[model samples]
Target: MSNGKVYLIPNVIADGTQEQVIPAHVLSALSGIKHFLAEDVRTARRYFSSLKLFPSIEALQFEILNKDTDPNTLHSLLAPVFEGNDIGIISEAGCPGIADPGSLAVKFAHDHGIRVMPLVGPSSLLLALMGSGLNGQRFAFHGYLPIDKHEFSKVVRELEKESRKLNQTQIFIETPYRTDATLAALVQVLQGGTLLSVSSDLTSANEFILTSTVAKWKSQPRKLGKVPAVFSLLST
Candidate 1:
C-alpha cells in the first residue's frame, strides 16, 4: 500500500479573520483530509467549523500534537499515515511548522519517505518583514526574546549591532501582554537611528503596522494592548 501524504495546513492568525486571510484553495485542499494533528483540538475544531467546510466535525479524527508531545511516540501520532490515511497538521495560529511544534512531524515525514505538502497561508513574520521596509533578502526570526529586563536590553543591543554589521533585519515576537514592555526595551536599548517595526493584530480589523526609528518611537509611544505582535529591527 502507498504511504499517505502529510498536509501542512495554515490557521488564521486572528479570530474571525479566516475569510479575510485564508485562501479559497486552502479550504478545497482540506476537503479530503479527515485525520488531523493539532496543538489544541478544541480551537482547531472551532476554526474548521467556522469555515463551514465539513457538515459534521465529529466525523473527523484529531490527535493532539503540542510542545509537550513525546518525541519517542511520534510514530504513533503518524501511524494513520503509515496505514495509507492522509493527515493534516493544524497550528494554533499561522502556518504549521514555522514556530509551531508541527515541524517535528514534517521532519519525521521527510526521514520516513512520506510526502509532505505545505499549503499557502498567512505568516506573521513574513508579513511583518514585507511591511517593515527592512531588508527582506537578509533576515532572521528569533522566536521569542529574553523576558528579563536586563537580559532583554542586552540582547536587543546585540541584535541591533548585528543588524548594522550585516544589514539584515532581526525579527522576533512577544507575548501579547508583554508587547508594550518589549517595545519599551527596544526603544531604550537600540540606537536613536535604528529602525524598528511593530506589527500587531495582523490581518485583523485592528491590524497595526509601523516602522520608525527608536527615537521616534520613544517620542510617540503607542499602546499595543494584549495583542499578538511581531517586532523587527534594522540598524542603518
Candidate 2:
C-alpha cells in the first residue's frame, strides 16, 4: 500500500513563529499525507481542531513516535510498510529532528533503504540567526548546553575558545522555563565582554532580539518569558 519511506515535515506552525503559533501552510502542504508520525497524538489532534478542519487521522493511520517511544515498537510500526509510505513526522512544534523527536524514524528509515525527505518549514535555528546580525557565512547549532553548572561553564568556555579560533558562530538554547537561571549563569560565567545575541518569540507579535556584551545583559533586568528562543555567541 506504499512506497516505503518516511518524510520529516516541519509544519513550522503559526507564521512559523516560535510563539505557540501554527501556520496554515503546514497542514495544507501535508493535506495529502494520510499517515503521519506524531510526537504526541493528543496535542497534534488539538492543534488540528483549532483549524476547524478535521482529518480522519485515526482512519488514515499513525505511528506514535515520541521521545519515550521504544525502539522495538518503532520497528514493528514501520515494518508493515514493506513498501514504506510517505510518513509525515511532526514535532510538538517547529521542525522534527531539530531539537525534537523523529530521530529514531529517520535512523531506521535510512537503515532500511527508505527514502527520507525533510520538508522546509519554520526553524528557530535559522530564525535567530537571521536577526542575530552575526556572521552567517559560518555557524554551528550546538543545541542545549549541559544542565550542570560546572559542565555548562566549561562547555561555554570551550565553545567561546573554539569559535574564536575557528571564527564560527555558536548557538544554544535552555529549557523555556529555566531561561532565567541559564541566562544568569552565562551572564556571570562568560568572559566580561563576550558578545551574545538572543532572539525571543521569533516571528511573533511579541518577538524581540537583544545583542550585547555579557556585562550589559547582566545590567538589563529584562527576562525572557516562556516563549521559544535561541541564544548565539560569536568572537569579535
Candidate 3:
C-alpha cells in the first residue's frame, strides 16, 4: 500500500559465461517517472553508468541515499506520488525491501497511501534456496545476523531451535569478513546430524554450492571473502 505507483527493480547475477544483466526494461517502463530512492547511491550510479544510461537528474533522480538518514526526511524523500510522479526503490542489488533500506521507505509510503510495485529479478537468497534442494516450501530468510559474537551465537541457537520444531529451513547470512567465523561457530554449536547447505560466490566464476553435515562443512575450503553470500540450514 505504499503510495503512488512504486516500482521494484532487481539486480541479476552473472555466471562466468553469461554476462550480468540489469532489468533495463524496468527502467524503460519508468520513463518520465524519475524519482529513484536507492540503498547505495554509488552502486546505483555505477549500474546506470555501466549501461550508459543517463537518468533525468531534473526529476531529482539518482542512486546514492544514506542508510542512516532521519526517518522523517527519509519518508519525505520516498513519499509516494501525490500529484503525478512515481517513486522507484532499488536495492544495491536484488529485490528492494527484502534486506535493504527500501523497506523503511516502502512502509512509510504505505502508511501514507503510496502504491508499491515490486519487480522480480535475481535474488541470491532465493536462488540459494531454490537450488538448495531443501524444504523450499517452508523457509525463513533471516537477514544478516548481529555481528556481535555472543548475539550471533544466540541468534543461531534460536534459529536452530525453530528449524527443528517447524521442520523449516533457516536461511541467514553474515558479512563477508565474518563468513569463516560464522561457519566455525555453526560447526561447533549445531547438533549432530543437522544438514547444512553453504553456497559461496553463487552465480559467479568462483561459485560453490555445498551440502553436508556441520562436521563435514568444516573441512571444505572457506567461502568467498568479504562479499555477499547466503547460508542455509535444515533440520531433521
* 1-236 per-residue lDDT for model 1 (tens digits): 99999999999998899888889889998999999999999999999999999989999999999999998988999999999999999999999999999999999999999999999999998999999999999998999999888888888888888999999999999989999888888888889999999999999989999999989999998888899999999998
Q: Model 3, 206-231: lDDT tens per residue? A: 77787788767666645456666688
Give me the runs in candidate 1 sitting further than 4 Å from their true place: none
Candidate 2 Cα misplacement greater than 4 A, ranges: 13-29, 52-58
lDDT at position 196, candidate 2: 87
TM-score of each: 0.98, 0.85, 0.84
* Candidate 1 residue 158 C-alpha distance from true site, Å: 1.1
Worst 10 residues of 2 by lDDT: 12-21
Better of 1 and 3 by lDDT: 1
Best by lDDT: 1
Ranking by lDDT: 1, 2, 3
- What clash count does candidate 1 reach? 0
Model 2 TM-score is 0.85
Q: Lowest lDDT 10-mer window, candidate 3?
A: 12-21
Candidate 1: 10-residue stretch with minimal lDDT = 180-189
